[model samples]
Target: MTDKAQKPSTRLIAVTLDEASIGHSTPDIEHERATAIWDLVEDNAFFPCGDPGTGPYALHISLMDNRLVFDIKREAGEQVVQHHLSLTPFRKVVKDYFLVCESYYAAIRTASPSQIEAIDMGRRGLHNEGSELLRERLKDKVEVDFDTARRLFTLVCALHWKG
Candidate 1:
């Protein structure tokens, strides 16, 4: 029997965002999308449960039928898992996140340093909440560290953005 240690660790090597689904997003949203993908590729722990294949995975994130889809594949392009999660649970949080982000950005322009910091803190809190919700939603389907989930949540939010 092969020892567990002999198996390759599961991690994401590349990530793609589906443009067709997302349409045209704001520059801020685009930046967030790019940054999240970059951060996720640079460092992440991603393991698809019930899949025996060891992987440096490639992920394609998109929205379809109001669901968030994770199209996962091995580095070699062989498909591993495709999981679709309902967006219903994320709607309120995403909306709230966007609102808080807008406030934070506006605050950065004119609010006092203390005010900006306070807004920033609230923004981060909402972001963390969204990430935690994402982790919970994916618990049965995938195993991911908090940071990975946070980055993934960003991408998910980008996809969820209407404008």
Candidate 2:
């Protein structure tokens, strides 16, 4: 076998949020959505088990029937894998994340610098927690770096957001 085939390098070339299905989002949430997709496409590692080809993949994220769906495809649009992860595990984290983000935004506008920094720290902690959870949930299906999981978690939260 060729060296390249033996050691595959994986990445995401594109990411799409199924906004129509998830309903509308606030401008803040929309901004987060755009940022996550941009960061993820710019750099990430995603290796779906059993795929022979190396990839710069395309990912479509959506929420359906309360489950988060990861629709992965090759760069040329060939199907790779569709992973459906239950939202139950993420319910508390997502809710907490939203609350923290709201506080952070408000703090930025009215609170002292120290207070804002504290809230921002909490927000980052919750974000890390959510990302770690995602990594665990996808462990069996795909291998992704913490940074990739972090960005994916942001998109997942965007999918879960109702407002």
Candidate 3:
């Protein structure tokens, strides 16, 4: 078996978050958004469904009319498909995720290792749920693995805070 690392042809070369849509975020929220985008660009498999031309894409995420918009384009800026997903489906999970995250952040300083671990575990669980939902919601529009979905989910949450 060849141990060659396969190059990801269908991956995001750039990601943009609408600053106006993401108004007045806390430092923590801003950091989370940056990290998620960085991770997604560094390593991800984001293939646009159907025929949207070839590899290497750029993604612009924004919120419009309480819907999440994914404006995809070619690396050189050719227009591709645009998808708008309603935020209603993600409300509960995102809310819970934020609550758990708050607890986990609070636990980091004062709680015991076990306590912190437990809170982090719950936080991860919520994250996974959000990721799964994102994958399911975008299944028809975009094809993304669990990891990619997770990072995308973080971006979703980032947009959701203002929505």
Candidate 4:
């Protein structure tokens, strides 16, 4: 075995949250969703950023600009927050987004290197489909107030990348 010390992996994006993503004021709601979502995530291997977690601890849920933010980090990224969600039925919102991220990563991980390479050449390539899926997970008319959705997009894209 090589004797060199393994380098500590670094994420370029980091997610940060204030007290608003779920709004502590709505503790009843926050607690319920946080608990459920947290549990659901814990069982899964990858996080929004495609990095596996001890659970869902890295997803920073907070309220920002009157919307809930599910901040996430993946693939050498830092502080990449989810698009602010301001629609009702928060449970459904969370559920869809989580599923989309989870499914994408699963596909990316299992695909052979040759297949992954083919992803770039397909008509509906991996990148395009992934972006569409992410976009679909977001509800219409919801407030996704990020200067550039790419911050969150980066997180989604990061999922499936092997460190």
Candidate 5:
């Protein structure tokens, strides 16, 4: 991990999801969203390409016209850059993540410990896959470390929640 203190300006300070774009979410989805945001703000590396404003950034995420949007700004609310990533590349992995998540959640309450662990492993794998894809997709626009990408992937999956 990069020394967060040394590169403090490259970190994210806040994250907000567009409520209107969120539609209606189940309690589980809401919990997932909250957890992802809390984890993200606690630790993340976000540096917009070609912008050297020395900014601890804030990110506003939303989905508009079937595109995933990343609205980055300085911690003090000055615009930095905005990126719209195509959702096509994410569709399959996101779908698989959701399926594994559903099974994991269900297994947690009813299955044996070993069974839950198995499902959890699959869930984590899918999460990692999605995170890697996100990191690749954002490579040209914004640079993010693996953990940050994982948390961001969780938020992305939260946005895709249709319940």
Candidate 6:
């Protein structure tokens, strides 16, 4: 076995996530329950939008990582879905990635797995080219397993994206 060096410090610990690790893809029941719990523990919030164009977002159930984000798209018949979200897995103390992921798993317990579609925008202005860039920035942070982060994101969305 190869020996690994211990990290000297975790001050730079910052939780991060990608579009693929969210909670809305789950069933309404599960998502609602998760979001309900989240609403009980948030300060401020907002709905995520425009892939955030590589910037901040709104969170309802605030954890760690002072950043926020959301995915946005216009659906058929003038409906728009802005998938807002939040995370807490940049371990300055301990590894919390799994814990955060657990929340996602719990929320998605009753839902079917789905795929995120590419956002199409030729009518209004919804730039979506920074996805890879955002993903790259989020690489070093934690991840949301089984839609756990969605419940957390619900907190942000409900509160209109506040910390």
lDDT of 6 by residue, 1-163 (tens): 0011111111111122343323344465445545555442232222222232221222222223444553322221222233322333222211232333344455466434441121112101111112222333334242222122333333333322111
Descending-lDDT candidate ranking: 5, 1, 3, 2, 4, 6
User: Which candidate leads the pack in lDDT?
Assistant: 5
Please report the candidate that would top TM-score against the real structure. Answer: 5
Winner of 4 and 6 under lDDT: 4
TM-score of candidate 4 versus the correct structure, residues matched by position: 0.29
Global fold similarity of model 6 (TM-score): 0.21
lDDT of 2 at 27: 88
Using all chains and alpha carbons, the TM-scores for the candidates as numbered come to 0.91, 0.89, 0.91, 0.29, 0.93, 0.21
Positional deviation of residue 49's Cα in model 1 after best superposition, in angstroms: 0.3
Report the alpha-carbon TM-score of model 1 versus the true structure. Answer: 0.91
Give the clashing pairs for model 3. Answer: none
List, residue by residue over 22-96, the lDDT tens digit for candidate 5.
Answer: 899799778878989999999888888778748899999999889999999998888999999999999999999
Per-model CA lDDT versus the true structure: 0.86, 0.84, 0.85, 0.39, 0.89, 0.29
> How displaced is residue 78 in candidate 4, in Å?
3.0
Number of backbone collisions per candidate:
0, 0, 0, 15, 0, 18
Superior candidate under lDDT, 3 versus 5: 5
**RMSD, candidate 4, Å:** 14.7
Candidate 5 segments whose C-alpha is farther than 4 A from its true place: 1-6
- What does each candidate score in C-alpha RMSD? 3.2, 3.2, 3.2, 14.7, 1.7, 18.1
Cα-based lDDT at residue 47, candidate 3: 81
Off by over 4 Å in 1: 1-8, 26-28
Better of 4 and 5 by TM-score: 5
User: What is the Cα root-mean-square deviation between model 3 and the actual structure?
Assistant: 3.2
Error of 3 at 146 (Å): 0.7
